[model samples]
Target: MSRPQLESDVRSAYDEVADSYADRFRSIEPEEAIDIAMIEHFGSLLQAPKKVLDAGCGAGRMLPVLAAMNCDVEGVDLSPGMVRRARRDHPSFTTTVASLTDLPFPDSCFDGYFSWYSTIHLPDSELPLVVDEVRRVLRPGGVALLAFQSGTGTRDVSEAYRRHGHDIVLERYNRTADQVAAALSVGGLQEVARLERSAVSPHERDGQAVVIAKV
Candidate 1:
C-alpha cells in the first residue's frame, strides 16, 4: 500500500480505539523495565529542563516520564482522537495533532526526541524521511530514543484491538537494530547506544529493540 493510504488507515484505526488504547496502556508496565531504563538513560544524557518532543505520543502516557527527568516535553500524534485523549488525560503538557514525517515545529527546536513504538507503522522506504525530520528539529548535541519491535518484516497487529470490540486493520513494520541505526546515521544522527531483547511477555510476539542516537 501507499504511504498516504497506510497513514490514513493507521490514523483511522487508532482513532476508533483511542479510548480503549488509553485505558489499556495508561502507564509503562513492569514488563517494559528495560525499555523504561533506556528512556531514563536517554533522559540522563540531556541537561535539566531540556526541551523534548514526544513524537507520535499517543495518549501522552510517556509525557510524565520525560517530565520526571526535568524535561519540558510536548507531544504530537497523527491521530486527532489520540491527541484529544492526550490533552484530556495529560493536561499539564501541550499536545498537537501532527505527523512525524512533517512536523509543524521549527528547526533545532528540541533537545530530545522520543518515539516509543511510534515508528513501527512506517515502512522501510519512509523511515528515513521521518528520521530527517527528527534531525531537522533537534539541536546540536540533542538525543533521540526510538523503540520498536525487532525483527525483519511487517506483521498484522490488528487482533489486539479486535479483541477490544474494534474492527481495525493495523500493520506494524519491524526492523533490526542495525537497520534502525543505519537509518539514523543516514539522517545525520550518530548512533550512541542500542539494546535488543527477546520478548518476555505473553502479550508480546517479537523481540524489542531500542536505539539511542545523537544529533
Candidate 2:
C-alpha cells in the first residue's frame, strides 16, 4: 500500500526485460512436479473452450499446460513486451496487455480464472479491487485458482536482480491464506479448497498458498 509506483514499476520493469524473462520461464521445470500436478488438476477440471483467463500470465508459462488440457485459454499481462513474447512463443494462444486490478474483459466473460505467481506484486490495498474484477468477469459457478506467497510484508526483488546484473522489478506482496480467502469471499467467491506446500527455496516464505474458489 505504500508504493503506488508498484503498478507502473511492474509494467516498465517487465517490459524492459521481457525477452530475458521469457527466455528463462518459457516452460516449467521437471523438479516442479508438485506444482505441475496442481496445474494439471486445475486444467483437467475444466472442459474444452470453457473460457479461462490466465491473469498476469507472464511470458505464457501456463500456455502449454492449459492447451493440452483443452481449455480455451487467453493470457493478460501488464507488460506489452511480455504479451509480445507470450504470443511469439505460443502463437496458437491469444495474449493481451492488461492489468489485474483493471481487467479489460466484459462482465461474466470467463468460466475459470488462473493466476499463478502473479498477484505477488499487488499491494494489499489493491488486492480487493482485483478480486472484485475477477468476480465481475466470472459467470455463475465459475471457478478460480489463485496462487501467491504465504506470509506478510513485501520483498523488493528488484534490488536482488540488480545485484545479479538483471533488470529491476516490483515488490512481491505476501499475505496469509486466510487473508486471500476472506478477500475472495467479500468479493463474492466461495473458497472451496486450500492447498499449501513448503517453500522449496530460502528466498520464499515458509510455504505457498493456493486458494481454489467458485462463484
Candidate 3:
C-alpha cells in the first residue's frame, strides 16, 4: 500500500477505537511493571527542567510516569481521537495529533524521547523517516527507548476487536531487534542497551524487544 494511504487507514482505525483503547490500557497499565521500569530509567537520564516527548503516545499514558521523574513531558499521536481522549482523561497533560514522520517540534527540543510500542503499526519502509525525525529533535546526550514486537510480519489485525464488537483492524508491522537497531543507527542514534523478554501483557503476546540508544 502507498504510504499516505497506509497512514490514513492506520490513523482512522485507531481513531475509531480510541476511547475503548484508552480505557483498556488504563486498566491494565498498573500491571506493566517492566515497561514502567524501563521508562523510569529513561527519565532518570535527564534532570529536572529537561523536556521529554512521548512520540506516538496514545492517550497520554506516560504523563505521570515521566512527571514522577521530575521532567517536563508532552505527548503526540497521529490519531485525533486518541489525542482527544488523552486531553479528556488527563486534562493537565499536553498532547497533540501529529505524525511521527513529520513532528511539529523544532530541532534539539527534547532531552529524551519515549516511543514504547507505539510504532507497531508503522510500516518498515517508513521507520527511518520517523527515526531521523526523532534524532533531529533530540539534544546531545539524549536518550530514546524503543519497544517493538520481536518478529517479522506485515499483518492486518481487525479480528482482535471482536470481543469489543468494533470490527476494527489495521495493518501492523513487526521487526527483529537487529532491524530496529539498524534503523536507529541510520538515523544517527548510538545503541547503548537492549532487552528481550517474553510478552507478559495481553496487549501483545509475541516476544518483545526493547532497545535503548543515545544521540
Candidate 4:
C-alpha cells in the first residue's frame, strides 16, 4: 500500500478498536514479564538509561512501571483514543498521537526505546522505515526492546481482527531468527539477546519473540 493508504488503514483500524482493546490488555502482566527479561538481558549494555520512549505505546500499559523505576518515560501511539486512555491510566507521563514511520522526536533524543507488540500492525514493506526511524531517534549506545509475533508469511486481513474494529490490515511474517537479526542489522542495531516464548493467548498461538538491541 502507498503511504496514504497505510495511514488510512491504521487510522481506521485503531479508531474502531481503541475502546475495547485498551480495556482488554491495559494491565502489566504479559508485558512486565517481557520487560523483566529485557532488563536482565540488556542491563550491561544500558548504563541505566534515565529517559525512555515507548514507541507505538498503546494504552501506556508499561509507562507507569518505567516511571516508577524513575525513568523519564513518555509514550506515542497512532490512536488518539489510545493516547487519551494512556494519559488517564498513567497520569504522570506524556502521551502523544504519532506513527512509527514519522516519529515526532529529534535524532538521538532518547536513551532507551520500547516497542512491544506494536510494529506487527505494519506490513513487512513498512518495517524497515520504522526501524530506521527508531534508530534515528535514539542516542548512540541507546537500547531498544522490540517484540512481535512470529509467523511464516504475510497475512491478509483476518476476519477476526477486523470484527474487533481494527482498521489496519495486519500482516504476519513468520520470521526466522536470521531474518530478524538481518533486519536489525540493517537498522544499525546489534542484538544482545533473543527470547522466544510460547504465546499466552490462543490468538497468538504461533508464539512471540523479543529482542534486546543496542543502537
Say which candidate scores most in lDDT: 1
Residues 45-161, candidate 1: write the lDDT tens digits.
Answer: 875459999999999999998898899999999999999999999999999999899999999999999998999988887899999999999999999999999999778888888
Query: lDDT, candidate 2, residue 78?
Result: 92
147 in model 2: Cα distance from truth in Å? Answer: 0.7
- lDDT of all predictions: 0.91, 0.82, 0.81, 0.74
- For candidate 2, the 10 contiguous residues with the lowest summed lDDT are 24-33
Residue 40, candidate 2: Cα error in Å is 2.6
Ordered from best to worst lDDT, the candidate numbers read: 1, 2, 3, 4
C-alpha RMSD between model 1 and the true structure = 1.5
Candidate 2 or 1, higher TM-score: 1
Stretches of candidate 3 exceeding 4 Å from the true structure: 1-5, 27-31, 201-203
Off by over 4 Å in 4: 1-5, 31-35, 39-45, 155-174, 201-203
Model 1: lDDT of residue 164 = 83
Which residue pairs in model 4 clash with each other?
A: 13-166, 13-167, 151-174, 152-174
Best by TM-score: 1
What is the per-residue lDDT of model 3 for residues 1-215, given as tens digits with 9 covering 90 to 100? 34423778878888988988898886335445776667767776664456889888888777767777787889999999999999998888899999999999999989888887888888777899889998999998888889888888765577776578777657668788899998999889988877777767565657888888889
